[model samples]
Target: MGRNTRKRRSPLATKVVAGAAALAVGGGGLVWANFYASAHESDSSHHRTRSAGAQVATIQCPDVGQKLRNVPRGARPGVDKELARLDEQITEAYARLASTRQAQSGDSAYVQNAILGPLKSKRTAALDRIGINIRRGGGDAPGGLDRFAECRGMGADQPGNGDGDGDNGNGNGGQDQDNGQGQDGGQDGGGQDDGQNQGDNGNGAAGPFADDFVDINDVQPNSRDLENGLAANGDGGSTGSFTAVCGVNENNLFNSDNLIVAPGVDNGAHHTHDYVGNQNNNAFSSDDDLAGADTSCQNQGDKSTYYWPVLRLQDGTQEFDANDLGGGAEGNVGKILKATEAEIKFVGNQQSDVVAMPKFLRIITGDAKAFTNGVANANSSFSCTGFEDRQVTDKYVLCPEGSQVVRTSNFQSCWDGQNIDSANHRDHVAFVQQDGSCANGFQAIPQLQVRLVYDVPAPTVENGQVQNPYAVDGFPEQLHKPITDHNDFINVMDENLMNEVVDCINGGEDCQ
Candidate 1:
């Protein structure tokens, strides 16, 4: 199948829901009253009578890739292509949902009939193709794949909240202004608002509404405890670290393709990403291509690839990709912020001597679809420079003056020993257990930790709206939720460099 390079259609007229009242606060601050009502309420009496209890916020479909654990090697390429098609289908369906708010408010069944129904049909055909590919690869096809085709409309309060999932139940229910005293003891500003009722500023073309941010001061100190057995102190484990001095993508290596997840498919990520290290990385780059690629790292031996979604300030700046499929068209707009500092480090395991990571080993730390897939695989950490100890998983932190925004991704440290990559791109690597030991028979490998710092203007939140808000690039339906932030890495290190990394970790020394 060829790549889907079609540009998204221009957004429709702004849709504003009824019952939202504009209120003036003290000091001329303007706030929208009942901001959350637009998430579900409608103005049409006939529609209200027909579906008074429905509050569909976003579409929720089961993840097909996560369930295909036994795909044969011969079928991987076909399955991956079909999976990317599935994502495209969802993106198109969500766009239709966002563009038809008026029609949805007039008839509850319109969404079911017009959007989700067609999506399911497309997914069913794709699923059947996947089964056929598996069978052709000399493997038994998994049964009941069509069961994953059906998708449903989810409300703001449901398990998979419309725009994205939050840490707790803090869906798009409006901001909790009680000094951050909300569920889960952490304030996430009620996730991302779908811009159902706000004007041009609340346009759904690019999201990350005012409710997606919470003042860092309002957030309670919730630092996580360190992993056990990290202290070297003559411990019988690898205690050293290897730091790779990769430039912060100064070469302007950017793309919308995700080689680890959707190889051979373009626009697989549906969002722009900043890349460092390996220079020859794209949807079609093979192991040989990466091995011979130029490196952005200060050391030529480290040809590993590291990438993550770009962060953008929603200040209406027309970037280079403003009109492209993965940029403005996919709801990832604004000025792309370059990381002031990008730190990539490899550290030893706490409980055992780390082994060399296999060449071409691929690892994806966080879940890019965590907004809809839930936080079980979400590992993103958003914090401030001075307050790095305090991190939030689902909310954008409003840093104080002179404090820069920080994003940290700690990749899995245990390897399953046999596969360099897995069907889900995760089964090959696993995080250490609570006791700092690799579970099952997995072997400990050097853990990759990436830290990125951005100096951005603090967003202004007045009334119930935000100005100059910044958010990570994400899927159109995700609304740029912080929980969806993720990182990707592919190890293409030469054999000598891989050995040096293992030796340095075991020798209790830090080397660059």
Candidate 2:
């Protein structure tokens, strides 16, 4: 077992959070350094080729680059080798489809294919859970750009929230009341400061994402920061989070187009519980306060992707685990990790100090940072406070020192905010933005990866498996659904670029 972490014994107060902050400590502040929390995992490991819900050590994830506290890296990191391994597994899956087909008579075979055409089919169910995509034919070529677009969708092109005469309160340009910087146009507000988080063992090992694009010698892959955001830590439970450090940019060492989305179905994938089981103490101890929470939150996909991924310094210094900080739902930008479908409360299951955001379409080449500072560092739009415990989403700019942006939240969106709840914050979409934090000469916007404190709910079958949409006459599983624009208003994706069977039942318009 690794050395256990202690929640207390810390220092370097960044900002004095209210008593109700989600990860709140007693002293009206978020400890920035000297945080030692001893955490224990009670679950035992099982063998015999586990499926999605298996208790395994940090073994399944592929390493990107992991080392102990700034130690130099070896010739290869784990991620590269795993990608190669994944390629082999996916290929084998394709071959399995053919062999399985041989064992059946014409009708049985036809029935089998008709029933389980895609990886989601009963016949191929096991294969899909193991990260394999076995369709009637095969997957699209790896890293195919157009296909990638179909899955991730363009950011700026997305239609605004459909409310009223285009003036319904969807985040728009109205000088959004800059507290420090603007809302990054993409990011929401509600957050805090960090000092003890990454400064733990020096090397400034805080978050899972590192800024090696500038130095390349500063990457640290293995550390506490990396361990927390991983699924292996969940003891086979579905709450663990994944972070990955792919070569999104050669010069910057970040991904500009990366996205991660949460499934909204109750008990959907990436389910989690938020802010559960925390005693109000005056001191801040990282005692897994958010663990065991009775809530979870799921959001729209393709916004930003933040899995716990590790990195190695160009100088060869090792850091956190490769899979510990970075690795998640196959880069789909919509797969779930830490979420509970039914109740939409956000949880803290992921590990890492600062939630890192990439400059839009541009990864950081140097000084990779999560920016525009201030209370914007907190998650969601609100925090909790007081004996009655009212929640408030206090939007403040860390860089400005004064409140430039000041937006509050209703309980409908967030749970609470900015109060002395000691492990209490609201559960809502982010409300802050990044202004002037982009890397020079990159893309039009900033790409982001947040190290979420996942507290997800268990995964549930959608529609009780009432229908297997993948089954169709004369259609490949990959070609079942056609992403047609609905009267140029609502639209859906084609199967080759889709995951679930489109609910063509209602045409999705819910006409009043």
Candidate 3:
């Protein structure tokens, strides 16, 4: 059942094309061109498998290439060490373009014009040695050196009023200004085309986190994006029939050091992970770099290693430090794209029979010390939109009229079919049969779902501080309150899409 489509472009379009080199050339692997959207194949012969969030159908728009003149009029003392070695050569050319998913390979256009085009003229000649004011499009316009659309909140468009901050007031720049009359209609500057966000599938209209903060690709599932598929329960609940989407690449979810935890130690997981598909991972990484890395996950050898833990929104009095990194240090905070979009559903018995999912598995969903420990780890979900039954630590939750603001996580699908790699990473794995099937000895797999969206109402001081309109990158600095939000996954699935998710749960078929 794979028929679905929606396309839209021109959000600052940029193209380069050309792919298929299979990368991994120098070593740290990263190929390219591996996209899959839908496929059902299962005509009795048995041995098909592949229907759990099969996404990656075109999500381009990150070229931020040319745009940096000559500016060397003021303090140029090695301009912060040449913008920290061009931020480690543009995060190693986006980790070799996320290990060759090929969006213009040839080493990602030679690291985007030989290392992000002269590191975008030494980051505007070191922000013109202080004095602030690069203003081309405002919102801290770094363009040329391409901060990758500032992790896709869309580098300062300013006016969407969804409130991430873009109209130049500076809480970090805003753009998604709604008009469809949703989040109390509109805020910031209720007009048209200032930062560009009117409506008609453009987001900024139809409000309230409009189907996952709109960059638009076919997010028509309104009602708060199906409000957790209407509380999908277990058994024959069919759990919204099936859902699977994973078109990510927002700078591999906050990068700088490359996660190594032991062997020589890199940044390790000291806070920072949204990752998605394999790029070689960090916290020390292994299994032969997950069998020679390179994946955004379309079966390309399924080099496992998906990640989590990077949500921290509380700009009420300042708490959004997604890695900072203007001059380096303070967590570097660069890569941006995920305004909220990564789904995968299948809670119970869409069919059930499951198996094939044992390759270095290490899933851990939610509770990263749930705000210093609170216990409740059953699948894990936090709410605040009409008080979906209430559960708060208050990182900034006002919600009232029509309600909105949520963070959901659900993994742990009772595996044990074998062993991938586990010590304490979560006892082998278990938890499914609540009608979803498996239990007893344990088997069933595939059930990711990691929803996150926020509209944030109340609190926006500005100069005096207090900003937080829902942000996340890697929490620490006193845990930004909000019960220390959490999430983590690592089941490099791709032994034929984990045997087509065990033939779509033993052939009950209902794919995405």
Candidate 4:
């Protein structure tokens, strides 16, 4: 009887001690859960103790984890691991949380105000560690930016160019730190800057966190052809003669502004034109021998020189029969150089075509047509009747500077001459003001207003995308012209800043 009592008492004592241990562990875990949430909130501190505490709370002790496996809270097996594995992960997560908190929490004015950024290795490293801990703890995975597949050792997500908008739900202009981070530890600090920089009339942002930085809208490509030489100037392809300068037409001469009326002036030893059409128009009279080219065509008081980009408001043009090689000509070149509807509309968009007006605002300002002697004009005839009318009416003003191809009634269609404030008046101020190349006397279009915009990359449509990036040359010296080649245009875009205009109608950033 004595032995039986002693055995029963010993077993009861063991059970009581185990029960007490279990209760203590559960209560401590409850305390630790609170610690986890608090540490996450006040993570800006360098609290080593807090980190160590977090490490212990997160550890997945297999003994506890397996026993609780059937429990609702343990369904994820979120922390199931042997003692060693549990310890490793807990330490890692805590260290990472500590590092990231320290990096972003730094308070420096220079760090806040830099154009590029507070570009600190510490910040980068911190972001990396946090991302690593998240992945290790099995948080949500980045969708296409698969960190495992693309990220290098000790890196974050690696998204491409257009991915800047992804995961940034608020459009706050800051990239998802884990999205664009690359192999080399956030080397390119350009993540914060918009695609284009220094807009002509843009709100200069202090930095990424500023209120008003948006996409650029008027970026133009700079070409070698702008300053030193024009594109294929000497080629039989178009503008001028191959081996010599040709005598220019006197009747159709103009200045860069297209508004100049050159007063009486000498032709400077070279044979000047009696009346020649613009290279863009291809109605040029090339029968005369080549002569020295007039170097200065933009000055206001020169008679020998006229204006450039000689725009004509043509409601109807018969010469388009010949120039529309795609429509009337027999050569395959026409088929190859076929201008699609997208290209046309893209040009119109860049020129800010009045959406309310007839889409006849065919934005033909920068369009070019090469004169292929026989192959081009084979079945078509030039507008002799139109030329005859010009000869008699406006004193034979051959392609008269600032002339209209519009029907007499449609003359007003080009531009509303009086309402300078009209949105349809063309935003030409950005051209000269931003370009920094001209004086105020840009020869004004007689009855219509001309708004000049620089950086119109010769418009093109390939692969269903309209690649007309109008870039502003921020170069200190002379501002360059548009990059015409498709590859070159894309290359410049991939490298430099460009304009992004929001469609007033659509209200979305327009980038190509």
Candidate 5:
């Protein structure tokens, strides 16, 4: 996308309350405590924590989509449309909340009356429609969906109050060591000293407060254990890898539609995504359309669709979508940054041989609503190129000069063998068990691992003020938290190419 010339107004000053303590562990590791309420918990404590003059950071609502595990195939289209509408409602409410800091500081109930109440009514209407759609499609309508209609304003101090799952407790903060940190140097480490006020970007609507960033140096080197019995080459498992040569979106295919979650609906994602591989991808694309369309991959036989939220630099550079619904208008303003390198690879399982992924099998690896939905499914990982040994899930990694930022997503590797899609879009696939074996008769499939590298200018965090920040585009209410980063994929490889991938991996031969 090209840059636009429109300049954003200076961001307004925002005051936030920090209630969590900073723990100092051995080896100089720092563990930041979480203060927000979990989304799955009741809101009684959340209400008790609210008071006049408290800063309402974002809105948190129950993830309605995750609850509908059995909508009939015929009803999914209509239900998906309504779900998309619910997202739009949240975005609208967040916009209003961001703009009304003055009123919020004065009247404690103002947010409840002006923003959340209206949002609840709209969500209730959409929920009603969803139930009707399921019934019309020859399925039993789920009840109590109305309980998910009411959203609450989350403050900064209420631990787990719609921020995340409060799992960043260990000093390591759930980081991975592989594919991390590049050896480079430039600029001072970015992050505010403990007890220092965080910087405000002034634009509350499009957030990523200064506190959202952390210096790579202060993070402890804590890496998670391998999943699915994965180990070194001596384990006697599928050890080969297959790489897909899809350039880093050089073709510049961009859209806000999500075919897997909200087919036939425009602006379903409410955020722009950089699309590679399949050239014909959008809300309305069908299997037939995709099969006939061109692709960006070097091997045309692999026409799988791969996409993820585009990262943007908040440098007041208006992008081509500046005035569009999914762009600046939805609080996702900034200069979009293309990935410097995109590595798409498929590997084999540790316990057994792998099977080919079903054609048109759709998979989503991370939670898009993680900011408000909790971190039960949060899978995005971030680190500096040279410091790959240290990764953090919630805070954006402030890469030092010369070093680049890295994002890695490892998709689920087990499938049920029958369905290509599930009612909730997750039941059809699963991650391997702790023993590295597929559970419940599920078969192991080639695991897809995507590593995206970006040469992002490290954001400056000083005296609680952030000058320019880079964040992934997401729903307005999400506030561009790094934990919300996710990836999407649809397997459309022709049988020949799919078989070649399986054989290449099973034979323990790296191929491209």
Candidate 6:
């Protein structure tokens, strides 16, 4: 895809909320899986992680008595003029913030404090002035532009965004680590301050990890392989069951200065992701990067960035055990590894043809916010001892004796055949039907699935406390909390493999 084509996007008709610049991806630690659909159909079967009926705080501007300006509802001529002027002022203020001193790539607080902080104050003041102007002009909210004020710093997941009803999960507010580590290499380390790696405190928390630490071997055991339940979807492509083994692309795995979450927001992921296939991929990594980065794929041209949160394991002993990675500074999560293979599979859609995904299109599956938001669109599965069939949600299942634990995620595969992205990032794609056929107007694409198998040891109980052997990377210090993890894929497939995938799906032939 050319840069010019990628750059063509609709302008923001309404002002985004203030503090938007600081809204990191997975901000508050809850990944905002902002997938979209024209209309969200609430399925009773696939429940969310949180109570669907939970109430979310409504974001609004300073009350201007009886009327909130509605941007969609145009204002009176005079009121419109004033609103336009204020919009310009707000835009200018944001520009000023952008021009402020630039912080180091991973310095999280620099943007929040120096840029967003001051910009918020200025915007809030300007909004307040707008209210005064509206009053002076003898108008009520000048077409609900007043409501835009409520969106200040709020994400698309928040309420009053004209989207469907669903509260963004509650994200825990803490500090960011400059050295990118906490006590003893734990996340949000709350115990003894045996300071190791320390980073610029983003949210003013002492560090990412606490004083206490748990070895990977010490974590409590969860699910394991079930007898006869661990079978792969046999008979492969005849029924749309297949696997695409994207080989290990070591060069693609690195500490990214760019945050993959909010590309516009610097260091938006806040934490680093283990990237594969694309060495130059990062937040703010442009079409140029996508077009230019080296690929570890056999094609030698595919640069799609496949990334996920970092995983950290304990070291040999206390003398070496650390929770840091990404440069392994003291107080940092240590030792990132490249997966031997990222096995993307297609299950359920046995009869659908795999269409080629558009270049530069971004798609995310699963919900990182699932933990706090209740399980929605969850396709997480687990296995042990090479058995791949067991799947469960919510609680982790203890594996059978002698089996290692594993996690699997399957992404939605039906596409609209038109738009590569939508407002919510999900509307453009739909899941295949029970028979594995795409809905009318949607095309079948290679169903992408990911499986992560860890080398965690057996669980042990110490002094009545159960230590699970495996936990996801980037979680808080607590062990085995039901986590909401997700995956992201930007299509940079080389034309050869892309065509082969399409043929496999269309011809009803399965191959690894």
lDDT of 5 at 437: 72
How good is model 5 by TM-score? 0.82
Better of 1 and 3 by TM-score: 1
Better of 1 and 5 by TM-score: 1
Best by TM-score: 1
Clashing pairs in 1: 17-197, 31-463, 165-371
Q: Which stretches of candidate 1 lie over 4 Å from their true place?
A: 1-54, 156-158, 161-206, 225-236
Please write out the lDDT profile of model 4 over residues 92-193, one tens digit for every residue: 232232223233223222112321122222233333443344356556422322221111111011122221112111011221112111122221211111
lDDT string for model 3 (343-420, tens) is 545444333444566766666654332222222331334365445454332233445555556666666666667664
User: lDDT ranking from best to worst?
Assistant: 1, 5, 6, 3, 4, 2
Which structure among the candidates has the greatest lDDT?
1
Give me the runs in candidate 2 sitting further than 4 Å from their true place. Answer: 1-370, 373-512
lDDT agreement with native, every candidate: 0.70, 0.17, 0.36, 0.17, 0.70, 0.40
TM-score-based ranking: 1, 5, 6, 3, 2, 4
Better-scoring candidate (lDDT), 1 or 5:
1
| Tens digits of per-residue lDDT for model 1, 361-451 | 9988777877677665667678998887677767789999999999988888888899998877777777776667777798988988889
Model 3 lowest lDDT segment of ten? 12-21
Give Cα distance to truth, residue 85, candidate 5, Å: 1.0
**Tens-digit per-residue lDDT, 34-97, candidate 6:** 1111112344553322212111111112222112323222223333333333333333333232
TM of each candidate vs. truth: 0.84, 0.18, 0.31, 0.14, 0.82, 0.53
lDDT, candidate 1, equals 0.70
Write the residue-wise lDDT of candidate 2 on 312-377 in tens digits: 111112211111101111111111222111111111111111121221111111000011111222
> Candidate 6 regions off by >4 Å?
1-245, 256-260, 314-341, 346-348, 396-402, 461-469, 474-481
TM-score of model 6 relative to the true fold?
0.53
Q: Which ten residues in a row have the lowest lDDT in candidate 2?
A: 481-490
TM-score of candidate 1 against the unseen true structure: 0.84
